[model samples]
Target: MVQVDVFWSYALGASFASAASRQLKIKSNPFQNDYFTYTLLYLSCIFAPSGIYLLWQFPHWETMQVATCHGDLPAWLVTIFSITNITQGILGFWVSYQCIKAGRYYLAHLQWFLAYFCMFFVLVHGWDGLGWQRFLYDPTVLNNQLWEPGQHMGLTFLWSNVAFTLYVMGIFVIPFMIIPMSKWIIEGAQNSPEVRSTDIPESIQEIGITFLKLVLGCSLGGAIITSIVIYIIRLITGNLLISFIFGMSICLVSGYYFFFQEGKICYDLFKKLFLAEPATSQKEKS
Candidate 1:
């Protein structure tokens, strides 16, 4: 039920800002435009939701170019899918913006991570090659073809894949570190003196490039380090899941330091960007 959509990414991005916002928190809202939140929220709705709709409606749309099922996707489905993605994003902004207005930090965090965590299974199992079924419903998570660049290694051989470790860590795991990282940011931000006002991002119509930079920075840093940690653990643990599990815990500690690890290259880049302000006056701004 918990679809891996932009919702999780948005939540993570929001949490990152919100957690850091605790530092910027004033008794009153800054009421400034938060392109970060808006960008993530919008991105989440567009890519994952409509993308999933296309995949579901077409079944194996990825294979459509060569497969006989290419014509199954209807123009109606396209219309509906586009409609739903936009509407869903708008609805999400409404609800999340309300929570932010009310300072319900934990409530918003709960909404995202609850579903985000489930994706780890999909990430792991997905590379397990074709015929991988869920324990209960027995659904095909992946239908990897031999001609495809993907390999046929299930969980058994997958755990030891160095490249695969890097791939998953970069795209999914490191970005995932945002959840815990945001938790710390929230706590850190909250501990500061309350501010007078802050902007509700959704209320504003503005855009910028920082959101992409911020996500990529942390994801890049977190992924590289975490992948190394997982690989090291893999050498000792000799199991993909176990190695990843341990690596995840390691990321928790790393996440905290990354926010403050000055001059440390990749990790600290996240800190610099996360804690950055476009201008001196923008400190308390979202």
Candidate 2:
């Protein structure tokens, strides 16, 4: 939870700072903007409130090579951790500002995206190198039987599972959602100048299609990008950061085109199969 909230704080800072940046045809969506801030802020600031959460909750995993117990959490350590989160948020904002000012909006997204994912990797694998220890240790899990009558792994096990699940949704899953595309849809509503009290969809099917398109488009884009990038990186330098950097760069550049195309494909299919037209469209052609 400590790592998760802190990461969201940084990501929230970066994502919000990318305001007013221009893409070729892309305009920021008002609804998407509010939604983004609301979700991230609610999880990060409102929930645990990172700083206080750290001081009171203590840390399970060794962060920066230091470990502390719950009740004995050093004020100084908490202070430092809190400072780091603050500084990280500040830095994220700074980086995003520069990126957006330079017309590199994708880099701004990368700032937070990279931080959260890197920390996630560290949190999972770098917890005394025992992240995988509990998973395969269970006899039932190994035997392909997940649940049993008696399972006692204590608070460490319980909190780790619960926290990671929620964090994954907040940090990873939410980002891949078609918030940006929905923003474009909102832009269409605004520019059209037709009567519209709201451009955002209120129905489940409409919302589901947006998310479904985002996932599929990004999946296809990711697979293609990975294949090309791995080949090039292997031929050059096979650094982990280099791979990640390349992956994000391509996603912003050529990858976006693919997302747009793939999203169109999904939406067209949905339109043909179910939706007569956009659910929000009330204006009739004369």
Candidate 3:
């Protein structure tokens, strides 16, 4: 708990610094604004709720667990919190995606955000082990399993709760982050003014279409790859933890490939969407 608190404090400090830097840069050159501040702010906002919940729940985990198990909390409130918790990391990625799509930052920043989420989850699940489903299915079962002299919710459980929350948060974060980032990279690489050094620009509608195509193509490819990897891992090992680790490894590799390999598969699909017509008209072409 202390560590987490300290972490938030450090983030707050960094946010302040980023804001100051952005302000200075804006004053010097408005058009040269760096989005580092906004990105930090987005990250802080996305995680604030989870951090608050962590602090509140760490000391009251048993009570909350019992409440969740018995449906003691109001159904609507429970649903809302569940959704928010589940989408915390995703919220961060979404903010980054909006920035990237709007050309607020470099492609690398988007990749960094996606990579951060992945590493965050890797740390989380690696520490907590993979009994999360069991715990969710039956809190009482977990209680029984942990029932022993001097064995109760303590520092260890507190840490585990943190990991569990992060894992849930990461479920949507990684996949969504990649979609916008991939599209932006492909578009920027080919016809963006930054790359082409031209005055004319691509139409918004065309950009949107290309983005959608990349998103759909990447989604299909990722799903297929993930499914095959998980199936093979399951066949090789009966242990959930091993399967999970391998699955995560595969995902990380796939993410790297998609983000940096120029997304050729999706690029091809984008071209097909318009019958091989240019997705974005280059300045020279225009």
Candidate 4:
């Protein structure tokens, strides 16, 4: 049963990633100049259902404990975790791919790298649990030792920590990336010399609002959801401080970026929207 769950989860993750990648390559450009927006929409549609399902089907307390105990988690719990991780990776990749197609390669690559890194971590950790019963039930059992010290020092532990760190950092950094891009994209659209006098400013303002919503939705929403999950996991595992730090770091970083950088973006967006129309109208009248 455990093996079946693991296989299914891997299949789902791979299938979702492949589908999302293909969807991102479809171009409805000029009419829709924002590849990021389209990709984000697509990802939200595809993965949001899985996320919601996970949230709803969250394991009961006893099950959570059984899974977290030093041995191989139950098949059901492994399936849930696998699905969650895979969905996260897919969303991150979709966001990155959109950015790259839109020429925002730095943000795109950052998101993509994070996505793959997270995927690697999920696979390693999930698979590590296959022989977990032996390690947890009998630590002194020599032949059953799943991980060598060198592997731990070199690959397993080191990479797991690295992946976790990156995951936390990526969540923190998302708001910062979105806010500036929002401002730039809106301002560029508004200030374009080719836009008509009446349409430019309104269109820009609408885009700005849309971007603001996207920032808030992804940053705050993700932070809140992640916090709840971490808290639950901590409760089950007795790793309170680690979970607190991880959750709080996300909130603090996202809050700082939104309050400072995003505030600036909002101000600039408003200024551009207000000025653009008048400037275009003046030229037309002259």
lDDT of each: 0.41, 0.44, 0.39, 0.38
Q: What is the clash tally of candidate 1? A: 24
For model 3, the superposed segments whose C-alpha errors exceed 4 Å read: 1-201, 262-286
Model 2 CA lDDT for position 75: 76
Which 10 residues in a row give candidate 1 its minimum summed lDDT? 199-208
Query: How does each model score on TM-score?
Result: 0.39, 0.43, 0.35, 0.26
- Per-residue lDDT tens digits for candidate 3, residues 228-252, read 5655686789766787678868886
Which candidate would rank higher by lDDT, 3 or 4? 3
Instruction: Write model 4 residue lDDT over 125-244, tens digit each, in one string.
Output: 223222222112221122333333222322343244333443564463344344434454445444545445554444434654643443344333443455565556677777767765
- How big is the positional error of residue 197 in model 3, measured in Å on the Cα after superposition? 5.7
Question: Over the stretch 16-124, how does candidate 1's per-residue lDDT look in tens digits?
Answer: 4344444333324332444344434544543445355435533332222222243665767545554554444444444444554455544443333322333333332
> Which segments of candidate 2 are over 4 A away from where they belong?
1-7, 19-51, 58-68, 131-286
lDDT of 2: 0.44
What clash pairs does model 2 have? none
Task: Give one digit per residue, the lDDT tens place, for model 2 in 1-286.
Answer: 4444466467645644542233221434322455344434443454335345533443433232133345455778666665555555655655665665554544555565555544444343333333333222222222422322233344454455334544654564344333543453344334543424353355435654644443344443344445456446645876756754675577556644643333555334333212222223333533
Which TM-score value belongs to model 3?
0.35
- lDDT pick, better of 2 and 3: 2
- What residue pairs clash in candidate 3, if any at all? none
| Residue clash pairs of candidate 4 | none
How many collisions per candidate? 24, 0, 0, 0
